[model samples]
Target: MDLSRPRGSLWREFFLVASLLACGIRQASGQIFITQILGIKGYSTILAVDNVPEDVQEYSWYRGANDSAGNMIISYKLPSTQQPGPMYTGRERVNREGDLVIRPTALNDTGNYTVRVVASNETHRATGWLEVVELGSNPSLSVNATSLVENMDSVAANCHTNATNITWYVNYGPISGSDRMRISPDGKTLVILRIRRSERTLQCAIESFPDIFQRSEVISLTVSYGPDYVLLRSNPYAFNGIMKAEIGSQVEMECVAYSLPALKYHWIHNGSLLNISDATMNLSSLAWEQMGSYRCIVENPVTQLTFYEDIRIQAPRILSVVHREFSILEPTVVLLIVWIVAAGVYLCGVLIHALINRYSNRTNRAT
Candidate 1:
């Protein structure tokens, strides 16, 4: 330890010691002061404190409040014993390196963040701000009935909001072919050609821009009178089942016939054609002898269809009491004449009694 060495040597050694002490103090100060940094809310980011001293104890972070009126209200606290505001809470190890990192940043993570460093002798702080944003949600779509009709040419329609475009398809059945129908350029309607009544079933589809195949609705149609022939047979030429009536009983029998074309009706009884001057042939009153098999013949010239109904009447049931009462009228006349003669005799007796009384009163007066 040559205390008295050359002056230059002493000076150079002293300067080197002083420089080393200063560097040590500077490092200590840097470690005491912690810094924090933040970025947008949705972005992944980091917290930086590059000027940390060599002996940093830890860090404290502060989350901002959600209120609009408040200015970065504290939400959490770190180093519970310190009990800073509830929001001023974050903890991490900060060493001389002064480098810090946070991964997988969240939207809530956006706010004012601070770093608190504690060295053996002092404490320091640094802060940074962060921003956040949210992405838009997926859109929705809807459609009318899923199918379409050709000859009716009615189309399936769709509705949606915030949509860019749409498309349609024929999904099922023999109408699976798409080329038969054409969609309008504006995606409004579909046109089909040479559509027969049988080809009424069709399927339609729709979509929106940016969305793949969203959903679908259906439609149905009926076509009128196609060439496909329908052969209608006559209603089996049914008779009115054979109606039976008693003579003298008023009978009204209707013979009805039906065909695509109109029909002419003729009435016949007992093998003789009934001259029907009117639609209803009136016999005025029917007699027992006139009872026989009655028929109505219906013929349609256009349809070449013929029909008939048969009706029969049984002979009248005559009462014997009515016949006996009619036969007694002659005897009733004879009894009536006898009662008249008895009344004339009683009238002559009354006249004789009156004349005798008158004669007796006159003779008594004269004597």
Candidate 2:
């Protein structure tokens, strides 16, 4: 064998490696397409690799311990399309067609996955990361009794949700193993049994899968009682009209109080509470006896309030009439004044006639 021929072949191999490196750099600078993704919990999301180079014929996925940085891990190839390699369990494969899908994923089942595509006897790899998030459902709360009956012995409250394997709580107090709290066999409803008056407060909460799902609005209750009712009245005030009675006539000035518990009624005369046990209080109807302020007060000890009305009484004017027998009964001083006027008129006429006659006689004598 010639030493020069071996050297020449070695140089050619070096040149080939350099050229491949340049080609790989140019290819990497070009745009690659990622059309789909998976590892989603609820909605249908698929991992799709689009516009893959025509030269690539086989593809596989792999996983590994976290990279130097704990932030990421890796996935790689497999021996066959049906059988993945050691670290590539639960991975997907892509053939001439470029597509991958993961169904019903778990949160921990997430990491960086590396795709190795083989074409033209060369290998090309790309890495992508997956994040598996757990999505949960909402909850509903209901009181066992539609209408809350106050002062009742005990009651039941229940909470329900659509998700499975639920945990319940009330005001942050866990319901698990609680004597008054119980979960339905199906995990749909949570019942709080034998609720006490002190425990009348209720807060229904739920946890779905990994997180606290929701909390219900608070409900409060209190004891009940009967109606507290009372009636009110005031005293009578100063009067505008006159009151009349005969000399020996009896007059009764009265005040009336009306209320239940039959109010503590008092008769007030000039601001003083008169001790009258009865509903009606009486006073003398005479001007001096009944003239001052009068009031009827009605009060309730439970209510602690007093009502008053002012009243005044006045005596009627009295006039005397004297009568005489015979002729028009000399209408008294009025009749006497009339008679004196008539007598004066008659005397004036007589005097006038006498003066006129004397004047006439003198005229006759003079003539």
Candidate 3:
């Protein structure tokens, strides 16, 4: 192709090919210079020279200085196709605009490049640098929202970097295409339609050749759920879901639920709301009327969820009441039993002394 003309021009008005007129040529009349290019690693990029004469006959691209024959990459004469020079590599091709295109550029490609343009009267040369970047730093991860309601809200995540190979993971497991997820073509942006509690952690990584793996910082999302798993109990004693306490004793009853953002607790007794409105219910000087079924309501305000649970707060009933009464009288009854036993031992001692005296007197009188 005639590389001297503009990109849209089809006519072979001029040509710049490899294998330059192996001679030292000064910078021609025009202020022509190679346009500097920043190329991405593992991607296609181009290098071109600007302000060239329209009547050019040939073009040559060189690796570095055009001082020797071995430095020429490619050159072409008028009416001739591009031919490789001694330094030509198979990875480059010149476009119609005399721009050198490199496919799959690399880090070693970051260096100076020179282009020589030929016209009917003179030859011109220009030099510029190409910088191919392979990012060594960690990628950045971002999310649209950090907090969401489970199964009702969504989140969008983005990984920002110039990396070509992007992989995403949720909770340390690789993620693939799914109905609730969306991934951009460049693997930069991701969206989840519905957020769940199980997917709290997310990450993106650049996977390159030769064991080059760079991971982004973790993106954490909070999924709100629950108000279930309700439990009701007291500190001293609770058996079979029933809170046990004694009369005239102060007791505490606690209600709890498993939920995010905490839960609001409400106590209930006799099918009516009690004044106690926290996770704890305190009762003192309990009587028979105070012993009955007690209930509590748990709610998650964020999730708009409510859970109900009931427990019996029985002080003592039937045999349990008898046992309680016996425990109260135990010390007094033990003291009375001790006094009676002591009195009985003293009476037995007196009776033995009297019998011994009577027997001795009878023996003496007989003697």
Candidate 4:
């Protein structure tokens, strides 16, 4: 890298970047493209160059279209060395690759910036524009209509901003022109011919630089949809398509559906509407009367769509646990009683045999 800029080199460098300082100039020897970029107020940004010759010895930067060497901001030697020029401000620096970096940029930074490169004996230079802007007002979004029904309603959304780099987002992601969506020429407005529930979150931002967003407040719209696919759920759920609960046990049946504006639930037993109106139906101490096809009707008031689902419930016969327990205990009790009786009989036989033995002995002794 050409790290040093001697006072004698100022006269030579003055003529290097001297021209009309137009954006992206092509020299007679080779081509050097200085990319145009944006700079935010009080922030850092880069003025990059492309197609630089590999045999570069030094890089020099100048401010504006000035032809005099006094406009030189800074210079960088071939590698990492830097020399602050006469016009050097504390905010400017040149990287090893010959790019100009400015930090905490000001409004005055907006203008044509020029860079000169010296490779071997050839001199190449180019200029580009840099527009510095303050982070402006947060974009405001307004829609003509909301709470619309899916596929049946359309809305016009407008983003209020003076920034030319308008970008639109749906559900926090970038969106482009589609069959159902259209954007105005200036990107200040968007129109959706048909709205869907999944496209409810709408937003806009200024992306003057790629991946950098000055975002606006999000707009959440409601698109009322169907009361679709009536669903049945239960506590102590159904077995083999039949909800079987022992008598005196409770069974809870719940109705569910996908709906907007909430769903109203009503229950039916054996084709007759029951008094129950909520999503839950509890059969406490289940009786035979509670046994039958329980139909749940789900309704969406806004969409006027209704769906129904059914769950079959049955109460098994009451279990006689006490009798069953006694049945299990009877055989065990009988076996125990037989064991005691046999033990007593064996004790009697042994006592009688001992008495007979003693009598016989006494008779023999008397003899």
Candidate 5:
């Protein structure tokens, strides 16, 4: 063997190895940085590293403060070999670019993550923080009673959810407790002590974070109450509890009751049912027989309460007595005129016969 040839071959191999080492050191000096990530539970997330060395050949992932004593999640070398811990059940994987992806993440995945990338001769490292939170589903709203009577019935509203921070709203504004309003300890249930007609809309919402909230379906409240401030009016005239109408004239009377859920009307005339079942009563071609005390009974269907008003209807005052007296005097006046004429004629005939008899007796005595 020639000694010079062996020395040249050894020098050539040493120079090639040193050149490769210098190239790896240059690539390792590149920046290794990652960004903090936020994730929701039951979703997918990626722990991405930025500025990764192009000549990197190995990657290692850890789940703690640093790689010294942290739990190893995944490790990969060069092109194929991969090592995964119990945490990487088929849902987690490391891509060729040194990025870690987790499918269907959970709350336990929140922590500091460290990624170490190795080139042929040097190592590079990066750390990132992951924060996982749970945003629960939307809540549902319910009520004990949809309709309530004012000052008589009460209503309660409940917001059903698993969220911790809950709030109540009425007509798009915050609600506070008072003598007529009450709130539960957990702020889930709201009760109206005396339900009113003004309270119409109610809503419930969950505050997941500051300025981040979700609202449930809106609820419309219905309140029912009285037939108060009842009124009875007629078309022509209504004065001194009387509705005046002339004979053969038409009359219309209306009964008005202020109430919720509407009202049913019943009319009475002279203590007899009028068979009319509506708020308006019509009398076409009125007669003297129709004159009587008319009463309107208004009843609330929801509360089963009743209100009443009374009015007296009379025929025209001038025509009523005139017609009565004219009918009575008509027959009497004709009979009296015939009797007077007959008596006058009989008296005149008797006086003429007496004068004749007296004149004849005087003439016979003078002869």
Candidate 6:
């Protein structure tokens, strides 16, 4: 080999390597940077690289570690389709902007994500962290009993969940500790002391993290207390203790008791129990015999409290007169005939006495 030729070739090779190294440094300075992402379970998320070069020839995605040490999730070549790994086979795709799109992500998909981009003269690498979490299934709320008697029975609302942090809510707000409302240490159970007749709503919740939480369905709580404030009302009207109705008229009476879980109704008339079981009693036709004192007895089964209200059924005066019309007519007719017969006998006795006296005097003169 000529000595000059060897020298020139060596110088050219050295320059080429230096130029390539400079080009690599420039590429590294302009490499893409991926941002950290948080993904929710069963929901899709994206891992995107910023400032990707237009001349990239090949793209590779890795999970859990760096490009050389991590498991390959997918790879894409210029002018060709992408190839995905078994775990993300159909669930992942590379968009036109070279961003990774995961459809319907799972909890297992969370890990360190790395992407390598091979350009014409340089290689670029970026890494990011992905955290996956779940709000989880809606928690379940249960109670020892749905209904409790006031001051005599208590109830516990239990929230069931697998989460680490649990919370309790009453009527859409956070529950505060009180003499009547007691919360357990784990916040899974809430106890109601001296439950009253007021209705309440309870709910449970769990937080996967701050600002991310799931809540359970609402539960209705009922406390049965009293049969107080009992009222008996009639359709037409009731004044004092009486409810008036005409014969052949329809009448409706209702018994109302302010109590939880409702009160059982027992209607009584003239110390006899009625056959109806509802809170309302309907009479199709009013009769004179049906007019009497009507009583409504309302009782609470939970508290064993009882209430009584009475209303007197008064028939119209016209109805009473019409009911005895035939009996009055028959007695009046008999009394009138007896008076006429007595008057005629008195007149006949007076006339006969006068005639006998006159005949005795005439007989004495003739002798």
User: Which numbered prediction scores highest in TM-score against the true structure?
Assistant: 4
C-alpha positional error of residue 42 in candidate 4 after TM-score superposition, expressed in Å: 6.6
lDDT of prediction 1: 0.45
**What is the lDDT, from 0 to 100, of the residue 52 in candidate 1?**
53
For residues 1-367, could you state the per-residue lDDT of candidate 5 as single tens digits?
Answer: 1011122355334433453354342324466755435655766666666577678898888887677633778888878778886445676778776777777778988988888888877898877677788877878999998888888888899999988688888888888888788988788888988788888888989876443567899999888888876898897778978777888889999998899888888999999998899999888988888888999999998988998999998875664444344345788988999999999999999999999999999999999
Backbone clashes (count) for model 1: 25
lDDT tens digits by residue: candidate 1, 1-367 = 1111122354435533453454342434434322233233333343444465565455444443222222322222223233334432242222223333333445675665555555678866554454434333333323343233324434443333233344444434423225656555555455555444455444443442122233334444443332222221111122344434454555555554434334566878899987762234444456776676767676645434466656665553666654344455878889988888888888889989999999999999999
Model 5, position 60, has a per-residue lDDT of 84
Cα lDDT, model 3, residue 34: 58
Better of 2 and 4 by lDDT: 4
lDDT tens digits by residue: candidate 4, 1-367: 1222232355224323542243334455558855545667766777766679999999899997642588899999966889888878898999877888888788989987778898997988777777777776678889898788888899898989888889899889989978789999999998988788888888998864444577888888999998768778887878666887777788998887777888888888998988988988887788878778888999888888888887887766665655334345888899999999999999999999999999999999999
Error of 1 at 367 (Å): 99
| lDDT agreement with native, every candidate | 0.45, 0.48, 0.75, 0.79, 0.78, 0.76
Which tens-of-lDDT digit does each residue in 1-367 have in candidate 2?
1011122355334433453453353324433323222244542233444335667656555543222222222222233344345543343444335444454455665655555566666766655455566655456666655333233324455555665555555555555645666666765565555443344455555554223345565655432211123222222332353344433334554434433234566777666767785555544334455455556565644335456555544455678899977654546868889899999999999999999999999999998
The predicted structure with the larger lDDT, 4 or 5, is 4
lDDT of 5 at 36: 34
Candidate 6 differs from the real structure by a C-alpha RMSD in angstroms, to one decimal, of 19.2
* Pairs of colliding residues, candidate 6: none
CA lDDT of 11 in candidate 4? Answer: 28
Q: Could you tell which candidate, 4 or 6, scores higher by TM-score?
A: 4
Q: How does each model score on TM-score? A: 0.22, 0.26, 0.45, 0.55, 0.52, 0.55
Question: Clashing pairs in model 4?
Answer: 1-77, 1-78, 1-79, 2-77, 2-78, 3-77
Model 3 scores worst on lDDT over the 10 consecutive residues at: 12-21
Candidate 2 segments whose C-alpha is farther than 4 A from its true place: 1-38, 42-45, 64-81, 88-96, 139-367
Model 1 regions lying over 4 Å from their true place: 1-249, 277-279, 316-367
Q: Is candidate 4 or candidate 6 better by lDDT?
A: 4
Ranked by TM-score from best down, the candidates are 4, 6, 5, 3, 2, 1
Candidate 2 to truth, TM: 0.26
